[model samples]
Target: MAKTSWHELPRGVRDAVQRELGGVAGVEMISEGLSSDVTFVAETGLGRLFVKGARLDDDLKARQLRREISINPYVTHLSPEIRLQVEEAEWLIVGFDYVEGRRADYSPLSPDIPLVLDLLGELSETPCPEIPLRDAGRLRESHARPEDLHRFSGDALAHTDLNPGNFRITSDGRAYLVDWARYSRGAPWIDATAFAMCLMTCGHTPYDAEGIMAALPVWKTLEPGDLDAVAYYQSAMRSAWQPRLDPWTNASVAAARRWFDYRVGLEVGL
Candidate 1:
């Protein structure tokens, strides 16, 4: 998606940001993420802020923006704080306190692995706030067995997308999970499972990924068949959703299949 430049935004939107931040000194556009039409960091008189938004006319993006804004309060401790919000007839923009960090590396030997696991441990213990969030099983409802969907139910709040880019590792080894657009209410192990998938994508085999995830407390509470059910559901979901011809989607599908097959092999004592 081509990012809309700072000047391309409506005058009303620009004015709102300037006024809210006191004054804007400079603007740096961020081009990595595809969810936002306008994403940039504004150097303001107050401070630098990470601003992201989409036009109100784009229903999907608009809803995602609103959902992200609504979930900010609940996740502020582990994520950035929402510093400003601009809602006009044509646009909805949100600004978060700029976080200085590097993208987390999920490779097999990266030291960032432990920091990521610790973040997940904290996230698993976070209480699910009372807000409208999608149920985790909805992603697998069309593919999972009817009897197994209940296994995904729990009061825990999970960041369902555990992609490495979504994690920010600070210089001091603190890990911050950003981008709550896909957050959902689900069992505590949902995050651990997602992290395992991410590890697999970064060259960790299924057994190695599971071994890494074992450090998280949530990964220890699974019943006899929980891992099998999650792996099966994740594989089914990944296979069903890889319509886009992209490297990321292709890699994810292959990784999920590997995980599901590994679980199945374990079941048969292979």
Candidate 2:
């Protein structure tokens, strides 16, 4: 989606942002994330802050924004600190302490792999905050068979989207996961499996990705045939996304199928 420029905002909304930031010296629009209509890094008199917003009337984006705000406190240690949020002229905008980091590399031998896995290990054990979060099964219902949904059942707070773009690696070797709009309550292993899918996309084989994750406690708790069920669920999701033809969807479908095929081979003792 094309990003909305800082100048494109209504004067009142811009004023609200400026007031919240004390004063803005410069603004750089960010185009990576899809949920926000306006995403930018503003150089304010106080400091640079990453900000994003959408029209209040867009129910989907509005809800996603709200979810991010609500989840921020709970996941602060794993994400940038939220510093500003204001609603004006029908637009709701939010700001966060600008993070100094690069997009995470999920390649087979990237040192980032360990940092990301360690972050996921912490996330798997982090208790779910008392907030309304969709159940993992329900979130995947349209793309997965009902019988297999049971495999995703649990109370662990899962970051459903594990795309490399959602991870940031700092110069000091710290890793952070961003975009909590789709976080769900699910089996602790869900995020690890999602990470494995991303690893495969970056050239790791199914066995290698799963083997690396095996060091996490979540992986050790998987019941027999659990991974096969996850594979089936993921393959079904790929089929559902096939018609989209978007680059992300296409790449994800291809990666998902590789793991799915490997699981099928395991089932047949190939």
Candidate 3:
């Protein structure tokens, strides 16, 4: 769906929310987002907050909300507070305490790289009963090729979409991950490889031997045939990239394909 403006909310829905939470003094439309409707800042008597609204009728929107709530607590170590949910007339509105931060252009390569890796590593380390293993398998199945499907049918949870834009870096230099809709359990190394590949695709040199080696140490320990699966998944992901969507997305996908092909040959003699 195309991006929506704050004024696009149904009059009844907007009125109902105002009645319940008291009149909103201001509402500003944010960027042109792909998944959900985003508002810059919504002012209330209580405080200023970021508002994200989705059509209640859309099943995908509803599921994304539930996913956000489910994973928010588990990832508190990463960022800003997850606000309460406000359901108003056919709309699911979620308010998050806006964290002041900027999106980093490239994945922090030195200290921050390992920090992000460790944070992601910890998520895969512990088992969460709330996150069903089946969901992970389903996601991998949807994204992986038939030949490589078996490798991703594991019991580990992974943040399937780990990119710079999805992360926020606070003034104090803390990284907070946003966008939980794509979080699911699956092959652990896939997340790390996805992150690295994404970085490389965004004009960062994460494909170098040193960078690959850094991730390989962690990736190799996660599962059998992990490296092979990572390369395969990277290629698959790049193959699906649509240049018409966005330039960055297009470049990343193209770079990931080449990087994976080169890495596969160097590593497995394939």
Candidate 4:
């Protein structure tokens, strides 16, 4: 998607956001991420803020933006704080505190994994917020085996998308999660499973990645059959949602295929 420049927004929308920021001194366009219609850094009298705006007319973007804003109020350092929401005309703009940090790396051997894992463990323990979120099984029902969907139910709030870019590591060496757009209510293990797949993208074999996450308490109760179902379901989903063939994407897809094939191979009598 193209970056919707600050000047492209309606006068009323821009004015509204300015008021919320106590008068915007200047605005810098943010050119990352596909979810936002207009993402920019606003230098305001109050301070610098990261603003992500989306036109309310685009149904999918609107729904994602609204869901993220709704969930923002409930999140702490787990995500950026929602300080202002400017709603006017066909636009809805949200401004968040801009954290000074860098994107997390998930390479074969990076110092970030331990901190990322700790964040995953802690976030999984967080109680689900009081909001309508995607139910795990139901989210994948059309593509998943019936038995696989059952593993998704639990009280934990899952940030289902674990792209390294969504994680921010501050100068103090603390990590914070960003982008609650795909936040959902599910079992704690759901997020871990997603990260387990991510670990594979970082070059860990499926079994080895699973071992890395064995520190999570859910492992004590998780069954191999349960993992089998999840793997099949994810493999199917990946097969359906095609991405542009770049090195990273190809590598990610290959990892998914390898994991799926490995798990499926283990199901001897099924």
Could you say which candidate leads in lDDT? 1
Worst 10 residues of 3 by lDDT: 209-218
- Say which prediction, candidate 1 or candidate 3, comes out ahead on TM-score: 1
Off by over 4 Å in 2: 243-247
Candidate 4 accuracy as TM-score: 0.93
lDDT of 1 by residue, 133-215 (tens): 88877766887778788888777898898898899999988999999999898888888888898888888999999988887
Better of 3 and 4 by TM-score: 4
Model 1 clashing residue pairs (backbone)? none
- Identify the candidate with maximal TM-score: 1
Order the numbered candidates by TM-score, best leading. Answer: 1, 2, 4, 3
lDDT of 2 by residue, 52-115 (tens): 9988999999899999999999998888888999999999999988888999998878999999
Q: Per-prediction TM-score, please?
A: 0.96, 0.95, 0.81, 0.93
lDDT of 3 at 266: 70
Q: How does each model score on lDDT?
A: 0.88, 0.87, 0.66, 0.82
Candidate 3 C-alpha lDDT tens digits along 108-190 = 34445555665666665656546543455456564566766767656666677777777766667677677777776666555
Give the Cα error of residue 58 in candidate 1, in Å: 0.6
Off by over 4 Å in 3: 15-23, 107-115, 125-129, 132-134, 142-147, 209-217, 267-270
Off by over 4 Å in 1: 243-245
